[model samples]
Target: MFKIGWLRIANGLIYLYILAPLAVVIISSFHPGEYLIFPPQGFSWRWYEHVLMSGRYTEPFWNSVKIAVVTTCFSLPIGTLAAYALTRYDFRFKNAVQSLFLSPLVIPTLLFGIGLLIMFSALGVKMYFTRLVLAHIVLTIPYVVRTMLASFSQINRSIEEASVVLGASPARTFWLVTLPQVKSALAASAFISLVMSFDELVVALFLTGPGLNTLPIMIYSDIQFNLSPSIAAISSLVIVATLAIGALLIIFMQQRTRKSTDIEDPKP
Candidate 1:
């Protein structure tokens, strides 16, 4: 009983440690003062209003959104197909191929960013947006592949075999039978891709050129030159947005799981 109590206390302390900074940032964002300070001088939404009205972050914010969307769009189908192939088929050097797809997860982000920058520079590629998207695709594919691989592995192969026995083409079986089983995994992969691409800073830092700013870069620049409540406001907005998205995704996944369960085991 004492050990269990101590573990609970430890967990509570850990959560507090993680959340304390977020609370401080959210609180500081409400400060009405020009300079940001902890235990804010007064409470106001001026910073949030300023953030909304100010044109400073608008373009970068949209840029980040655009990049994240594009990255997810490209990453999802490619990763899903790769994952399906890897999980369903036994091929030459199967383990090696899987490891290759998953290598990005093990590689250091800094080194990957640097390598991409160098490769792009040497190739005389100057399209920052395209380069960034491509880099993001590479970085995000591993996550998608990993997620879908697990989902695909868990699926019953007998169902797919039955579809083939019913005269369904491989493509038809994949589309109508196999894909439906892993819809939740697809959503998860897309969400992971979107969030990772949106929040990625190191790769963006290396790839972004003049006139190609992202929200993170803008926030970083503001932090370097001017420390203001607006920074905290923007950060708070990001935090809230991330949390909301996560909550929505969780709800979506839960609904999907419930519906799938109902379909699989309908009651008369």
Candidate 2:
């Protein structure tokens, strides 16, 4: 009983630590004052209206959406392939290869961004939408690979063997058998990749030039020079968008899991 009481206290503290900032930001966004403040002087939707009407905010928000969508599109396939190769097949330097793919997660984002910027400059490569898309993909692929790897580990290999034994080609077996088993992982990875790419600022700060600004970069720039409640409003919108995507992904995975279970355990 003593331990249980201690655990409850610890959990409450953890919850406060995680939620305190979020609560403040949400409250501050509605401040009647032009500047941000906690226990806002009064409630108003002026900041939210300002954020919605400003092209500076809307443009970057759309840029972030495009970057995240493109990044997820490219990262999912490449990450899934890397996950499959690492998990299913025995190859030379298998562990080393997996480590290399996941290394971005450990490396400092600033360092990675600096290195990429230097390389692109040396190549005389212009920073364009396509280049920004590629940069986001690099940051996002590690999350995809990690999530898919977890899914691959949980799946049974016998299903793939059975498909092959029934005269399915290797590619067909993978598409028809292995892919279905790992669909939940793919869904989860895509959502994770979207969230990572959407909120990423460090790499964008180095790699993006004018006209390629992302939402987080815009927010950072605003905070550096001003303390407007509009910034808080933008942040609250981002938080809502992130949570909506996460909830949708969860529903998709849960539905897929139920369908898979029904297929595997059919009854009269």
**How high is the lDDT of residue 77 in model 1?**
96
User: Which lDDT values do the candidates have, in the order given?
Assistant: 0.94, 0.88
| lDDT tens per residue, model 2, 1-268 | 5789889999999999999999899889999886677889988999888889867699899998998998999999999999988888999999899999899999999999899899898998885677778888888889988988888888889889899999999999989999988888888888889888888888888888866788998899989997789999999998887888788888988899889788889883
- Give me the candidate number with maximum lDDT: 1
Q: How many residue pairs clash per model?
A: 0, 0
Candidate 1 is scored at a TM of: 0.95
Q: What local lDDT score does residue 163 receive in model 1, on the 0 to 100 scale?
A: 97
For residues 40-101, could you state the per-residue lDDT of candidate 1 as single tens digits?
A: 99789999999999878889999999999999999999999999999888999989989999
Model 2, total clashes: 0
**Residue 156 in candidate 2, Cα distance off native in Å:** 2.2
For candidate 1, the lDDT comes to 0.94
Question: What TM-score would each prediction reach against the true structure?
Answer: 0.95, 0.92
